[model samples]
Target: MDTRERYAAYAERIAGVSPSYAAWARSLDDGVVSVLDEVPESKRQPELLFAVARRLGADPADPGALRALVQEARPALLGALTSATVQANDPRRLAPVVPLFAALAARVGRPLGLVDAGAAAGLCSIPDRVTLDYVVGARSEVVRMHTASVEPGLHLVAEASGAVPTPAAEPIEVRARVALDPNPIDLAGPGAFDRLVEAVPPEATDRTALMREAARATLAAPPVRIRGTLPGDLDRALEALPDDVVPVVLTTGTLVYVPGADRQRFVDRVRERGVHWIALERTGILSGVAATLPDDVDPADPDAFATASLDGVALAVSDPFGVCVRWLADPNL
Candidate 1:
């Protein structure tokens, strides 16, 4: 698709998430996009451009303002777009997978050493640190996983389908928290935190608050951040985890950035280590897992739906951001 069509499609995708961005995408003319002529074709994404504009103190919805900002600070825009690895650090996505951690820990009879693969600042790595409420199906049967007795400062909710997986009777034990990213973000500082929050749609205050809460949790006890990417670096990451604990590697909404052909290689790497792999990746991202999904539910739009897999088997169909879930198999099985 051309630049015009790409923006139009992006507008549709974010209509609910960021009406301001949708409006910006729809209203921006050809002249606005021409500013990206010098950037690489792969880097000229709507969200990336909008994030760059916002981080640079400009309103992307206003074409005149965004264009002016880009013109005055072209180098900054180029640097941000080319090198930035901004992603949706939605901690809520862990609602469906948190229980699995408990189950795995119970099965192995050891504490878990979690390595967040492709983690952007390890935001989702704190699943065990938060209280997640899952309201199952349309009937709304609620399931709560309380990881701690202390009053949790962070509570997140997601609607789910199918039977909610029962966590172990005991609370989860996370002996080691580590994350692998090409550039690990340090959330203790203000600048990195602001840039991450700004990358979210400007008007979605609800999600913005969620991001803040998760950020605070991560900052209080940061993960052992490792500089790496998937497939090629999985071995090195696993080696860093404690030997006594069950190694749990999780990848959420990050596989799409991995070259399409290499996704299965990452899966194979996880399996070879005899580690538990929890993946909340775009639907059909890994052909082996997609092949196991029943046809009735397999064709859901990959942009909106994701396959939650454990140990290379698809367990549920979930919203990419963790708003909803539909379990298909027992994750611990």
Candidate 2:
């Protein structure tokens, strides 16, 4: 699709997920899209557009307000586009998958030492602090729903059809949490914090609230954030962990930014270390994992937001932002 078509489709998507943001997106004239040309290759990403909009103080409910900002603040928009990297990572997404991580830790029967790859602020590293309400069979002849509260004030509710393996809800013992990033966000820095918040759509109030709470929780006792890129620095980061702790590597929506070759090499490096691995990335982004999936799964389907993989096997398909989740009937559990 061309840039116009891509943004149009993104507008349609936002209409479904967030009507307020959709108004702002649809109001973007072709001239506005053209202004995005100031940046080399970011006009196609919804995240960048929304982040720029938020930074401009565009209220999601008011499209005319955003349009006015675009017309008046061209320099500011262009500057943000040129200077800001796409650090649109959210910890709320990890809330739905917390059980999956706990399940993996239980299977290993060891204390976890988390190593979050592409962890911008290390928010995704602390899944142990969020509560999840999972419904395996929703509105079926036999529906099963269970709520597990691990931490205060953070909850993710999800549902799936058919029979599924019950994920263990017991909190995984995490002794150390390490975050790896090319440039780690300093929680104390207002600029860095604002960038993180602006990356998410303003219409997602639930997400925004959860983010602030999670950010505070993470900052209370910050994780060890290593300043380095992935694959190249994976070994060094892993080696930095205490010898007694069992390393569990996590990558969520991070591998999409990595080259396919490097993604595979990163996976290999994790396995070579004999550590438990959990990854949540867009479908078909990782060739090895995509090839492992059944032929029935189609990346072209808009509903197929991402595939959750355990050690390289595709287990469940989930919404990109973790609003919903559906586990495979037989995930090789």
RMSD of each: 2.8, 3.3
RMSD of 1: 2.8
Residue 229 shift from truth in candidate 2, angstroms? 2.5
Write one digit per residue (lDDT tens) for candidate 1, span 1-333.
678887887778788888788887786655567666666764667777787778778875674666676568877777777876665588888877776676677788888899998787788887668776778766777778555433334687887667567744777777788989887888876587776776788788898888888887787667988898888988888889878888899988888778766777887777777888878887876888888887778444633378877777777887657777787866655
Q: TM-score for all predictions?
A: 0.88, 0.84
Candidate 2 runs further than 4 Å off: 27-30, 35-44, 57-75, 140-153, 188-193, 329-332
lDDT tens readout by residue for model 2, 159-276: 6543355655466677788889887887878676776777677667777777787777678657887988778999878877798888888889888667667878898888788887
Clashing pairs in 2: none
- Candidate 1 global lDDT: 0.76
Compute the lDDT for candidate 2.
Answer: 0.72
